[model samples]
Structures are given as structure tokens and as C-alpha cells.
Target: MPPRPRARTYDPAKTRAAVTAQLEHVRDAVRGLGEEQLAAPTRLGDWTVRELVAHLSMAVGAVGRHLERPAPPAPEVTATGWVAATAALGGDIDDDTRSLAASAAPAELLDRAAARFAELLPQAPGDRLLAARVGAMRLDDFLVTRCVELVVHTDDLAAALGTTLPYDRQALATATRLLADALAAKAPGGSVEVRVPPYAVVQCVEGPRHTRGTPPNVVETAPLTWIRLATGRLDWSEAVEEADVTASGERADLAPHLPLLA
Candidate 1:
């Protein structure tokens, strides 16, 4: 894995709106799930639909939970650093998700989470530090990570249900950019240019830096494809083979450093 990269800032107001909007998208869809549908298996290991939805609530509800407590002394990580640190917490996340899943109906869980998040967002200062699961981050930075959480799992839930869910434009864009920045941080260099059209384009993978017209190595894909690739839901070679990802030059093979935050 690569070290954390330079920090990126997000618009605090837009982040708050994006988080709420994306959660609304999820809550609306989860409200219609039957008992059997809640039990459906998802691609995330053994996490069923119920557990996945529970995780979403937990991810958002964390804001109020954090705000209720004393603010941390200082931010320990940025949004990108939070991304780099998430892989090690999988076991704890699973345990907590299962516990939360058993505590309430999916819709209710989301309602309370969404409600509390909305309530707290108005009073909290953007620079206030929350002791997040991985470490402390500003309220705004933490919410940016929440966008990643909501957008990524929205796709997961959609896949399990054999349908598509809408993405809040800002949420999807934030998630795509954060994950793309994480990839660049993990594989630091300018040898390859990764393009997720209309959202992000980052130079990464250590080698000769491109300074002129067209770079030798370039990888291009849709925003969702890039997100799935960064999070390990989509395989690099598989994407290339399926015509979902276009890679040029030898350095474009990113499988070795993939699943950056999964």
C-alpha cells in the first residue's frame, strides 16, 4: 500500500447536502424491501441486504454520535487518509454492522440516522473534529467519506436487488474523486494518467513523469467503473477484458495496487 497523499479540500456545504441526498436515495429504496429481500445475499462477503443497509445507517448516524461527544483535540487524518486507513477495520465493521442490523428494521434504522444527521449538520462547525472510526477528521472531511460510503454501497445494494439506484451528483463525484486520489496516493507518480470522465483525472504510478502533449500511459473508464475498481468490486483485467476499462502502455496495469480502500 502507498502512503497518504496530499490533502484535498471539499466544499463543506455541498458535502452536507450530498450526504443527505444520497442517504435519501438509499432510504427510499430500502423502505420498499420485503423481509425476504432483506435476507438476500450481496457480493460483500456474507453481508446480507439487511446488514448492508444497517451499515449505511451506522455510517451516517455516526455524525450525531460523534457530535454528542466531545470534539477531538485535532484532526488526525484527512479524507484521503481516512480512505487509506479503512482496510484494517473490516472485522470491527462487520461486527458492528451485524449488531446494528439486529437492533432495528432497515427503514427505521435509516430514518433515525438520516434524521439525526440532518439535525446535527446545521449546528456543527465544518472545522470541528470528530473522532472517526479510523481517526479524527473534520466534520466536513468526515462527511466527504460518508459520500464515498453511500455511493459505493448504493451500487452494492442495487446489484443485489438487480436494479439501479440514483446517485446524488455531488456524492458520486466526491466518491469518485476521493477514490481516484487514493489510487494516486497509493501508486504515486505521473507515468500514467487515469481518467474518470466528467469527474476526475489523476496522474499516478511511479516512473517517468509526463510533461508534454499526450502521455504514454493512460487509463480511462466511467466514474462507476473507476469506483468499483478502486474499491475492489471490479477487477482490473476483467474490466479491460470486458471493455469497461481502456488501458494503454505497460504501466496501466493497476491490479497490483488495487482495491485501494476495500
Candidate 2:
């Protein structure tokens, strides 16, 4: 892989708030589900709503668990790199998620995990480096990764349950910006401008550069659609066919750079 770009900075406080808020959003939705709903299948291959919820707890719980370990000397991965790296660990994650789901009531599991996360996050230092599967990342960067996890999987839960789970605005914005920046890092150019309204606008792809005026190549979509596209939840052509995304200009085709994170 190409050298990782300089990691983006996130406000420590906002990240902490976002993580908590998004998790609570999922928690509230899960709390109201009946047994039948908990058993409903999700799009994440063989995982049910319960298992998906269990996995979400694991995602947030990771922060506290890592903080309990000895701090690492330095960070081993950039925030953007975490996105692409996750695809390789799918099998392990699936097994662990299933196991956790089977071990506790979904509501109980989520509550305990959320409580622990809430307790630990405030006490942790933002600059402290924690051991991550990818490598050591500062608490803040790791938390931003949590925003991506919470936001993306929350969408998964919503789709499975056939209900809208409201996004915490800061959480959605941070996740959107991180993924958009990841695309720019992956392509490394100013040839294409990708706009996710109200949150992110990034220039990417390698070709003729646009300095000012209307960008020669432009691709735009809503924030949720952009998230789905970046995370591989939505196909580029399918999104375009459904009118969910709009691209204009010869070099604006982003199929080659899309789903920046698997």
C-alpha cells in the first residue's frame, strides 16, 4: 500500500461525545426490540440483529479494553488506514460477534458495554497511545475510528430493522469527513472533487488538476449515500442508476476509487 497520509485531527471532546451519542442511539433502538426483532437477519452475512448489536458493543468496548493495556510508544496506523485494513479481519470479527451475542441478552450486553465505555472514556488521556489490531493509535484517532464503526453499523442495524436510526450530527459528519479524506489519500490528486453535502468536499483521482471555477470533474451525493459508497455498502453504478449519486465530467467516474474501505 502507498504511504499513509498524515492523520486528520479530531476534537477530542466531540469525538468522545459522538461515540457516546451514537452508541446510545443504537442502544435506544435495541432496547425496544422484541425477541422476534432481535432474531431478524442483518445484511452482514449470517449475523442477526442481536449479533450485530453485540458486535457494536464490541466496537465501542474496544476503547476501554485497549486503555487498560500498557500504552504504546507511538501510533502504528493512520485513521484512514484503519478503514481499508478492517476487511482482512472479517472472519475473526464474525466469530467473536457471534460468541458475544450468544453469551448475553442483547440489551444486557449493550448496556454493560456502554456503561464501561462511558466510565473509561472520560478518564483516558486523548494523547495516550493504545494497542490496536492495526497498530498503536492515539486514543483520539482510535475514537474517531469508533465514530466510523458506530455510524456505519448503526446504519446496518437500521436497514435490518426497517426503521430509521437517527445519526448524531457530529458523529455523522466526522465519519463522512474521515472516509472522504481516505479516498483522497488513496488516489492522491486534485483531478476530481467529491462532495458529500453539508459535511465533506475532497479532491482526488490522478489526472488533470482543477484550480478554481467550477471543477472540471465533480461527483456528489448525500452524506448517507456517500457513507454507503465509501464503505462498499452501495455499488457505484447501482447508486447512479438509483439517482443516489451524480457525477459529471470525463474524469468524474469514481468507480475505480470507490468503496475506499471494504
Candidate 3:
């Protein structure tokens, strides 16, 4: 069968603004966390709050570095492929992030990183193509990945701190749509409708397609819950038992296709 269609086209201007706004929000939250809090353990296995913060900066600042280089001939991958690309550089990225966090004060590093992103981001053109290590992808398409990092890590920070940080609407929406599309791409099914309330809804899993009325299979959760599930931060069974996710229908179970980033 052909690949399931990707949902939710993002406007470059809106996406850029969202990334900027969300990064600022995360930086502001980071600034408030004391050194002790910054050193706290995160769900991301060996990564403390410090490493996570550094990773966020790496994600945002990468666009600047790519933009500084000449544009690539073409995008070797789609935004859909980016979700898979993340794992390839995991080791090196984590190493650099750990070194950066160790050498600088978390607060100061966040400040400098935010400033650098602010300065370099504006220089990138909307249509500029980036030669990402995983594959060539448009600068705008790459920004969508940034939104995922910013949103997901922001949630991680909040979870570790036992507090909630305000999420930028656009950032949350873009992150939701991207992950949802990634799930559809990975599963490539028309059986179940996965609904992330107030942000996105996608049909995935293999079965008979529902053309009208209620689908035979349905799964539902809020955006953050879905993000956590998709990224392995939350377990499917736990979510299902805690009422964080609602699932139904014979084909509704998505356990096999989950934790897409791992």
C-alpha cells in the first residue's frame, strides 16, 4: 500500500515564530531552576536536567549552523523521516551536550544559547535547504523538528521540577502534528483514529478504512500525554490504566508501533 498522507502543513513564518517563542519560554523556565534542580535526574536515562537543557540549545542552535553553510542540492528526506533521524546522532549529541553542561553554568549557558539562537535564526531564509547529517531537509522542515525538541524537553523539565511551564500554542500544535504524522508513517494504517485533543487527530494502524461516521478503532489523549507516549517517556499500559489514554476497538491497541523515537 502507498504511504499514508502526512497531515497538517505548517507555514514557515508561523513555525519560525513558534520555535522562537517556545525556546524563550523554556529558557525563562530554566532560568528559574536553581543549580540543584538543574542537576536533578530526568526521564531520559542518564541525562540530568542540565544535559536536557543543553540538548534543547543544541536543537535550536543547529538551524543557525546549517543556515551558515551553503544550501544543499535537495532534501534527501521529508519531515516524516526526521523523527527517525534523531537516533543516529544520539551518542555524539549526548556527549557534546554533557561536555557543554559540565563546562558552563546552566543558567549562563542557557542565556548565551538563547542569545545565539536569537541572533542567528533571523539570518536564515525560509526556503533555504539544510544538509542535515541524516539527510538533506528544508530549513523550514527542520524547524518543525526543533519544535518537537523544545516542546518535549520543556515537558521533561516541568516533570522533573514538579511544576508546569506554559507552552506556546503554536509550538504545542506543531509538535503534536509532527509526531502524529510520524506515527501514521511508521504504522501506515487506516484502521484506528488517534486523537490528540485540541491539537491533532490521525488515522493509523492496519484495518478496514472508515469513510464516514465513527471509526471502528479509536485512541485518544491530550497533546503532552501523546508526546510522552510517542517518545517513551510514558508507558502505554500506565497511560491506559491511569486514564491518560482512551483506547477502544479490536485494532485500537498501538503498543507495537509506539515509542517511535527509540
Candidate 4:
């Protein structure tokens, strides 16, 4: 596997709006859920709906706080690398999320956090590089990560309530591209082409070179399914059984390199 690549170019204006729009989508869905629904269990291990909401709020809040400090002299990690490296901070993150969840009602907590985030957003410049503990990353890059957080957690919320929520296209696109890029970084090779149609397609894994038309090895899935696979929400065999994923060619089986984050 090769090191993660620098972030793909993002339109700061579009990305900012994408983050807010995606959050509003989640918030709207969250508001319609009853109290009992909020107490249900999410697919994230033992995390309940309430804890998931609190964590989403934390993802948005981190940006505001990082913008409060000075940018680092240089980034320690690339944008795609951030996804895989997140588990490194898992312990403290879980503790903080649980603490936040315990301190207040989910609705009220997310409301206040959203309000705080909105107030600080306009004051932040797109070029500003936030001094995040994971690494120093641009404000726009941070917003892209928020899209992943919003999309993934929203899925958790829906799974908990036995319902499905509509995903904002731009949010889904951003999340798909980021994760796709991460996979290419983790398993660097051009022998296989992994496609998430209409969103992203990345070549990865080491094997025979295919420089011409019709690559020999390929894996394909929709954006949501790809996200679930990357995050460990769904297993390789389960996806195959459900027909959510389609793999072909000898090098296409990726079960050996999965659940990038524990």
C-alpha cells in the first residue's frame, strides 16, 4: 500500500453548503423520530441512537474549535489518510462522545451544537487550515470529513429506527470519493478497478498491469454499500450474499483488506 494522496480539489463554497445541507437533512430526519426511536440501538457496536447524534455534533463542533487556533506549520497527514488514522484516537473519542451524550438530551444537545457551529462558520475563511489533533487540515478538508460523519451517522440513525433517510447527493459524493481514495492509498495497485458508479472509481491492489481497455479485475458497488463495507458495517460475504457488491477477476476479492477502521 502507498501513502495517502493529497486531498482532491474541493470548491470551498460548495463544500461548506454541502456540509450544512447534509446536516439539515439529518436534523430533519432526527426531529421526526419519537423518543423511543432515539433510544434504539445503532449498528455501531453498542452505540445507541442518542450517542450517535452526540458524536455527529462533536464532528461539527471540532471544526469550530480548530478554527479558533492557528494553522500548523505543515500537515502531518493527508486527507485520505485521516480516515484510516481515525481509529488511533478511538479511545478518547468514544469517552468524549459518551460523556457528551450523557450530559443532555439528544435533541437539545444537537440543536445547541448546530447553533454554535453556524455562528462560527461564517467567521472562518475557506483557506484556513485547522489545527486538528489528527493533523492540520484545511477548513474545506475538515468540512468534507464532516460530510462522512453526517452520512455515516445518519445511516446509523436510520438503521436504529428501522427507516431510511435520503442522502444529499453532494454529501454522498464527497463521502464516496474520500473513502475510495483511502482504499487506493491502503492497497496501492492498478491491477484492480473499484467502482462506485456515478461517484468514484479508483484503481488499487498489486498484480498484472492492465494498461488497455477493459481491466481484468474489478469491484463495483453503490456509494452507500461501499461506505458500509469500508466502515465494517457490512462484511464481504454478507454483501456478496445480498448482491450489494459485485466482484470479478482473480485479484478482485478484497476480504483480506477490509474494515480499514476497527
Indicate which candidate wins on TM-score: 1
lDDT of 3 by residue, 1-262 (tens): 8455745678998998998899889878887778789889988888999888887877777787777788889778777788977777878887888888788877677677677777877777766799876888888889888899899999988888888899999999999999999999888879899999898889888779878998989999999999999998889999999999999999989899888775
Candidate 1: residue 142 lDDT (0-100):
90
| Every candidate's lDDT | 0.92, 0.89, 0.85, 0.83
Give the clash count for model 4.
0
TM-score, cand. 3 vs. native: 0.95
Clashing pairs in 1: none
| Residue 105 CA displacement from its true place in model 2, Å | 0.9
Name the 10 consecutive residues with the lowest summed lDDT in model 1. 1-10
- Which regions of candidate 2 deviate over 4 angstroms? 1-7
Question: What would the TM-scores of all predictions be?
Answer: 0.97, 0.96, 0.95, 0.94
Q: Return the clash pairs for model 3, or none.
A: none
Candidate 3 Cα lDDT to native: 0.85
Q: Give per-residue CA lDDT, model 1, range 1-262, as digits (tens).
A: 3333566778988989999899999999998799999999999999999999999999999999999989888779988888889999999999999999999999999999988887888988999999898998888889999999999999999999999899999999999999999888888988899999999988899888888999999999999999999899998889999999999998988889899988
Relative to the true structure, candidate 1 reaches a TM of 0.97
How much is 34 displaced in model 2, in angstroms?
A: 1.6
Worst 10 residues of 3 by lDDT: 1-10
Q: Is candidate 3 or candidate 4 better by lDDT?
A: 3
On a 0 to 100 scale, what is the lDDT of residue 103 in model 4?
Answer: 91
RMSD of 1: 1.8
